[model samples]
Target: IEERAADASTPRAGPIPPSQRSDMVGSAEGVTEMAFDASVLRERDFRDTRRRIQLLARLPDIVAGSVDDEELLVRVSDTLLRATPSASAVAIVRANVPEPMGAGDEKPSNEHPSKMKVLHYDCRENGAQQHSVSSRLVTTALQRRESVLHLWETERNGGIEFTAAENVDWAFCVPLRSEACAGWAIYVAGSRALGSNWKELADDSATLADRLGDDVKFAEVVGSLISGIRQTSHFQQRHLAMRRFFAPVVLDALSGQDPQSWLQPRQCDLSVMFCDLRGFSRTSEMQSDQLLLLLEQVSAALGVMTRHILDTGGVIGDFHGDAAMGFWGWPIELQLSDPHSDLSASAHVVASVLAAARAAAGIRMDYAMGQTEFRCGIGIASGSAVAGRIGTVDQVKVTAFGPVVNLASRLEGLTKHFGVEVLMDHASASALQAWLGQDEFTEEPSPFRLRKLGRVRVAGMKIPVDVYQLVVPSGGTQDLTDSQIDAYEQGWDEFAKGDWDSAYQRLLELPAWDRPKDVLLRLILQHHRIAPSGWEGVLDFPK
Candidate 1:
């Protein structure tokens, strides 16, 4: 009989006549007729469609709520298991995934990221991964870049490798990303618990698509989400390390993925800081037998300096044996719309310089080199510099270059000459004073005492620079009190005015142990307590 006889689903304008709707009950003249009903089949299909709709509805929430890849996979795997009651197992696999970024230099594995990394595999009660058959299904799906359906009975593995899991009679696999590495896929397998056929509950009419409704689309959606997450995670990890050097805007540009535009040569105002260990090199030389121990101590000190600079949002640069350098204001300062925007980029520069000085003062490690503490000398200079990838064609680095960089280095060297831990060039000193005049700085007793230490002709430079000392008394170090500082300045004014006798008398009144006083006193004694002819008061540093 045609299904139209059984199907009450024929579209018609009016209800059928009573004779047409009624079943033919008896045989007449060797002719028999029977009317069929399909309400049971329709009801089954309706329930299946509703179940799939419900499962698909829950997936968006699942993807959104998942915090990590593992969590995402585990939750989605649970959903898959619940969706297919006849399924003995479901699995998510990353097939032939390429090695991670920056792994090119390593000796590769035998398969070279081939086959798979099984993300999730769930079977029935007391279940284990059916690797033998599952591997085949994953490979087939990924390699073909499409779905694979296999009947376990027809495709048997007679060799050592088991062709199928126990009681898993049939399986289907769907491809995720075909071009990602090799690819990714998901698979579902039927169990003998439901007998050899799906028809036990399917009324002998169920098809695979009918059995696994919405699964293909669901898996595809999940695959796309995973790909996005993977890409994002890679960038985050890469840039998190880079943040220790690059500015926020530079990092943003990098994340936007066009380095060619912004990373080119940039000339802009920058604050450069140079720090060198005071006694570390001498200690290392003296304790040659314990060189390893000395090296560790020096490294720890550098680490401390590096941490402070990074915390203050500066970029680390050259490593000159016993020293390290870091700077601020790179790749041009885009005005950050932060709450401190009114403070301006100069504020950032000033803050970074102070932090560098504080870092230098705080480093008083005791390596086994005599009884001297491993102190550091820091120099800070603020001016214009070119900030970018600077080097020859083959080798390059993200660094700042210019006279400001040299001045920072020179000031660092002058720290020993001045008998102070930190020194700054004229421009840096002016910036510090400018920032200190602000309301924020006046509220607290400044941690560092800033003083103008007169102009000096630095070696290898024709132009003279006004030197300044930044003093932070720690560890019972002898620092000039306000009274002594006032007294020294009075003497310095006289000395600058060519009244050596007056300067000499005033300087002697201060403590003998006052190193700044001693340095000035020596300068006077060298000039025979008299200003030389045409003396301009700019003491030239002997090379």
Candidate 2:
């Protein structure tokens, strides 16, 4: 056997057969013919020229075959045997060794055992009895990093002779290079049925073997790209989950910080808001069998509230039976990024919650025909609280814990008693006041109208807390008329000073639309009761 490069431009011994002239194997039917650069070539050059033509006929199949890798390699080996005619069997082996598996300072050696598997082949009757080439020779060819050949002959006395094998008596091994796997392919050819020209067949086989190496590399690259895309998709899903529960500015900061450190439990200054639908229990009981209808009405009302809250950069914490809890200024710093932004964040929280409450109160649904419109009450508080993750590992929830949250809930409950839609504790009320008092805010007419409700010590609290009532208009910033504001404050001052007779007469003189009539009415009823001896105008509500 012999090995050498096949000249690319050469004429075949005869016209290529119709069966082998398919487009799959590359069409040679066109008119262009190659022109040789040299004149007067030698005998060996002529043989190389002929060998090239035969190999070129099979080029298209190897490069663009529709079949899989195994089938493509089998076709290459079978084509080589067909070209030789003297060979009757073939095998296409795949390399299977791990690449660079050693530890530090360890180097690989040539003596390492070769890992290989047969990809495809054609075995003839006599060829099945013995291997045309031994595995050791295959390893030796790989170590040498090139093609090597061996030939033997049967002696007249029935003993084998160590002579160069002719067309029917040779074995050859060719290395197929690839970085994807640390091994080489072995093509074993066997037979004894022809005149000669074994050297040309060996040369053609070596050429096809090299191209096969490239095919393996291409597969590896495709596999790697798919893996990378899948990993990116997973990260995107996690990013979306976090975004759903936090604001964009928070996420921006979290991207650079370590989650393990920030997620630990700690105290943080935050503003918490709680909103609940008033008389929802009675409403649900009335629409008992039509739960779906109730859900549609409630969802429509809540959807508006949710959108406004999210727009204001508030993180929704939990959605209990008929209420939603939300907060701001935790999991990250709440520095004033802009001039108005200092109080704007808290102001937004109040405005959004009030807007939602008003919307819920005014919603009219077809399913609730003849029923009264739904109304919601909202309460907001600002203070320091312990904030962190809670629940089991698999289903953890991020939430805030402390009196700040509890007070917000209590304030929501007081909305019904005060006959108001929205209420807030001192911290949040102060922030709103600061922004509303600004020139920018005063010039535009504030989005909210504030009323100072008298101090009261709520249940479970030692200190009396100052509360305020907020009136949010339906569309834009439109404060109440002067008469409406004057009437409520005038009546409140007299009531708080314990002058029951004057307070009763002042509230009685104001028009019904001057303010919420219930506030004055409730005060008149309480006015007749005897107060505790040390009362400093603070109402004691133990419930």
| Top candidate when judged by TM-score against the true structure | 1
Instruction: Report the error of model 1 at residue 138, Å.
Output: 22
Task: State each model's CA lDDT, in order.
Answer: 0.64, 0.55
CA shift at 361, candidate 1, in angstroms? 3.7
Tens-digit per-residue lDDT, 162-270, candidate 2: 2123122444455554433235454544433342543444323332222222222222222233223333444556668877677776777788565667877789777
Best by lDDT, which number? 1
> What TM-score against the true fold does each predicted structure earn?
0.57, 0.54
Worst 10 residues of 1 by lDDT: 3-12
Backbone clashes in model 1, listed as residue pairs: none
What's the CA error at residue 239 for candidate 1, in Å? 2.2
lDDT at 244, model 2? 69
RMSD of each: 13.9, 15.6
